[model samples]
Target: SSDVVAGYLDAKWNWSTLVGKVNSSTWKAHSVLSTTDATKNNLVGVFYNPTTTTKGNKVFLLAGSLGELNRSGVQRKRENLGLKLVVGDVREPTGSEPSGRIDWAEPTSPLNESTKTAHQGNLTEFLAAGGSGVLTEDGTLVFPLMAENGNGDVYSMMIYSTDNGSNWALSEYMTFAKCYNPRITEWEGSLLMIVDCENGQRVYESRDKGRTWTEAFGKLLGVWAKPRLVFWDVSLHLD
Candidate 1:
């Protein structure tokens, strides 16, 4: 609540972000939130919704780490559009952590060490930031999934929940064999998933909104470490 840099874009694409805050307790004013604190999770997206009661108006804070699903206490208000919101904060009521911040101006999205360990299994304990999440035009919140077995074998799978974060199930094994940390983007009416391994950078394309994926190989499909995908200005780019 105290450290937030918020911005808004009007109909003209003119934008502005908050640069200062007044500390209520001491009434001391300070500059904007530190850049180091905000970009830790490695992703920031405006989970767009075009088919909801809100007429697809922006949903608050749908852009955090992948453990977002396990944050039980944070309230998600996008069930009307099948997107879940997750928030993390210090559990101690008297602790220094800011109140479970829900600033539309600046959403609180932290990848946390959760206390509710029942549903998380080992997934919560490890590096849970699998990939950038996507909200489909059909209103499904799909996360690039990484599933690990008791035998310590890790497999890539896709997970989605139509009812926000209330229920989730594996969509399918990724189109490639033995890959993890899949980055996905939607372009030209297709879902493009990219990942890299010892073999090379593998490209997977899904035309049916993630139900099925096909291997789309390219010249640069190999000779790289793990790769990530991003979409901007009607183009899909790899990073």
Candidate 2:
């Protein structure tokens, strides 16, 4: 297994990250990703919470970053956040690298101009839902995401890639406003999403990659109930 960590950097006004391999007893971590890298020059270096998922020998890392724009002599950040995908190839332990290593390729922005136009500019402040992503049985890479609209209302959705990592797209469907912090996974042939709503935690399942979502009544315990003074949110996953 492998692990990743992200921390804020005061100097760069952004964040830095480290990746490591989890052995049975020890975790050998390596300093691989940094916001200061020239590859992220166009951005403001504010790479936020990162989520990861593995497929075959490839590891995909997704993070949210603010756009950088120069206004006269001052640099300003964009109102809406953008998502970036960084891919790495896992390597076995070698002579110089005893703990093995991941060679991370340059970051790519999946939400390109065409993608934004396709969405009709309805989503703003779109960011990755921190935690782990899911790989479906059909080999689709799915990651949970939270987005805000013009009214500043937040909702949960998904971003997915069908042709491996060659291309990516955002889900057409989304949870109701104010329902955020989504935890998603694939069960059987459906994608299940557990989100904390205004009333309480609710379960939603989508059969068609995220074109639509339906509330899954009685699918998970402790869901669809009224919130209490002290209660823990339920998360869904398949062993």
Model number with the top TM-score: 2
CA shift at 38, candidate 1, in angstroms?
21
Weakest lDDT window of 10 consecutive positions for candidate 1? 46-55
**In model 2, which runs have C-alpha deviations exceeding 4 angstroms?**
1-28, 37-44, 67-81, 222-225, 228-239
Total clashing pairs for each candidate: 2, 0
TM-scores, one per candidate: 0.45, 0.75
User: lDDT tens string, model 2, 1-239?
Assistant: 11234321122222222222222244434444454541243554456667888899788999876545535577575533477788988778788754446778877777776775577438756877777899999999999999888888888899999998898888998898998778888877899988888887778899998898888876465455346586644452221
Cα-based lDDT for every prediction = 0.42, 0.72
- lDDT by residue for model 1 over 1-239, one digit each (tens)? 12323222123332331122232343333222332333223322223211111113333233322211223466532211122234222122346743322223333322222321332334321223234667777676666645454455555545555665445555444444356666766766777777654465677788775667777754443223334464433233354
Each prediction's RMSD over C-alphas, in Å, is 13.6, 8.1
True-structure lDDT of candidate 1: 0.42
